[model samples]
Target: MPDRRDLDIGELMTAFDAVVRANASLMTQLSSRAGVHDTALRALVLVSDTGYSTPTEVAGFLGLTSG
Candidate 1:
């Protein structure tokens, strides 16, 4: 295979920064909503961050049960 040396660190950093900023904005909005405590918000964040999770796993981590 030909040498693959094609990647832009600057662009990657920019995209990462944008994602971080957007996540922060959404987190603030969600936190302001009623009936949502820190634990719930954290569970949501963890699920979103990890991209996929089972209810049992999340519940176990959050000290909740899969109902």
Candidate 2:
């Protein structure tokens, strides 16, 4: 984990948001080439990062409908 003592919470969130945006942009391009939806790639990334995930968690992360 990154050392949080030297960074402000807001600054960290801003940085994380920026990184997520950049990654999303990249995922869009890659998904287009690979013939997959960007959301699929994003969900896979979220699951991969956490090592394990549930349907509810993935749905929430991807803003997918649970119904």
Candidate 3:
């Protein structure tokens, strides 16, 4: 495992931000190719981030009525 003690917080944050921007860009591209709206793409990302496998959990996270 890498040494966490040797990592600079500022540098780590910068790297993380870069990766997030790249991921967002990729998601945008994929959304366009899939013909999905931005909201649906964002919801998919949110579901993946939250590790919610059930629609009920996703709906709760999205503040939607699970009907």
| CA deviation > 4 Å runs, candidate 1 | 1-7, 35-40, 47-67
Q: Candidate 1 has which clashing residue pairs, if any? A: none
What's the lDDT for candidate 3?
0.78
lDDT of 3 by residue, 13-56 (tens): 88999999998798889999989976688789887887765876
Model 1 agreement with the true structure over 1-67: per-residue lDDT tens digits: 4334334666678899999899867776777784687578978878999999898888887778755
Name the runs in model 2 displaced over 4 angstroms.
1-21, 65-67
Q: Cα RMSDs of all predictions?
A: 7.5, 6.4, 6.6
Estimate TM-scores for all models. Answer: 0.47, 0.60, 0.56
Alpha-carbon lDDT, every model: 0.78, 0.88, 0.78
Error of 2 at 55 (Å): 0.4
The TM-score measured for candidate 1 stands at 0.47
**Number of residue pairs clashing in candidate 2, backbone atoms closer than 3 angstroms, sequence gap of 3 or more or interchain:** 0
Model 3 stretches astray by more than 4 angstroms: 1-7, 42-52, 60-67
lDDT of 2 by residue, 5-61 (tens): 656887988999999899879999999998989899878889999999998999999
Candidate 1, residue 9: Cα displacement in angstroms equals 0.7
